[model samples]
Target: MTTILEAKHVNKSYTVHQHEEHQILKDINLLLKQGEFVTIMGPSGSGKSTLLYNISGMDQVSEGSVYFAGEKISALSEKKLSKLRLNKMGFIFQHSHLLKNLNLLDNVLLSAYLAKNSSKEVIGARALRLMKQMGVDGLASHNITQASGGQLQRISICRALINNPDILFGDEPTGALNSSTTAEIMDILHDINAAGTTILLVTHDVRVAARSQRVLFMLDGKLVAERNMGKYNKQQNIRAREAALSDWLTEQGF
Candidate 1:
């Protein structure tokens, strides 16, 4: 498999009050192969989200480097980085982050519009297709405030995939949903991964992590351990996978 994303000796720190420096990520190294699904799990403030941000270029690493599609992204100018993110990568956060002024379909089409890689007609058609695939096509004309949390999340997924990004970075994508809704979202994500989009998610839910092919455990700003569960098969027992992952996480002192 091809390596789509990599982090090498990455470190992230922030200056505190202009006097002290606090480290958020410590010497993190990782490689995400094409079409793989990986999850990061850790306690709050353990730097899992920080690592995601640094590796995705949403935040810059204070040291070392991040490479996307074999290019050194950490050294790129902000304009170039923005273009790369717009064209090559996708993001889904805990919140939908949809604009209040735009309808759901318009919101999903926003990034595609900015990318300008396709005509409005082409992007519109793709956006509608994504919305239908996510089961939110009926809500296309609705405002963000009109949808439930789960529905909004599905819309966000549509927005993320509008550009057909090579990789999808999710920060607690299902954190706010109920168990049933979380399962629905995870199923959609699993299908997306199966369709060949690499995914890296930061999550606290064991259910979410169990669905991933690999899970990374973080502690005190360091990557402490990793568990490979292999690819998910629909015929396999999900409960067993979740139990095994829970046991490993416990052993890691999570």
Candidate 2:
């Protein structure tokens, strides 16, 4: 299988002043294969979100490079990057960020509109199918304000999948949900990955990270370690994962 995404020694820094720069990431390398599900784990300020933004081209890197499907993302123009993001990548955030005025069906179809790929009739059918798969089809006529947190999250997921992206990036996807809802969402993501979409998820939740096929641990703006989650149960997996994380944290004196 071909690699769908690659990050080569990617570095990023922020300038708080004219001469002061804060390094947020250093020599970060990552490669994601088709259908692979990887999760990034870290404490606050670990540069997890920054890495996602850089990979997604929402933020520019200060050094190194990002490539998607063998094309260097850093070399692309903003318009080209937007096109790539619309057609090749899907995103799920901690917040829904749904359009308040659009009905659930329209909200999901908006992704197709942004990609400029399908007619209204085609997108409407696709959106309804996605909503049904997500168990939100019954709420298609409802507005964002009318849905529950879980329902809205499901709708957001439907919106993300409307474009059939090859790669999915999720930031704290289950952070705002109850335990049951979290499990539901996780199961849904697992099913999606099983259906062959590459997934890169960032989260502080041990349970969520434990479910991934691979885990990357980060601290102090760098990737400190990685672990394989092949056969471990959630308890054993999280314990081992956190131990590796704790060792890295202590080594860095963080």
* TM-score top scorer: 1
Model 1 lDDT tens row, 87-179: 999999999999999999999999999999999999999999999999999999999999999999999999999999999999999999999
Task: Report the Cα RMSD per candidate.
Answer: 0.6, 3.0
**What TM-score does candidate 1 get on C-alpha atoms?**
0.99
TM-score to native of every candidate shown: 0.99, 0.91
Off by over 4 Å in 1: none
Q: List the residue pairs that clash in candidate 1.
A: none
User: Candidate 2, TM-score vs. the true structure?
Assistant: 0.91
Clashes of 2: 0
Q: Model-by-model lDDT, in order? A: 0.96, 0.86
* Maximum-lDDT candidate: 1
- Runs of candidate 2 with Cα error greater than 4 angstroms are 231-254
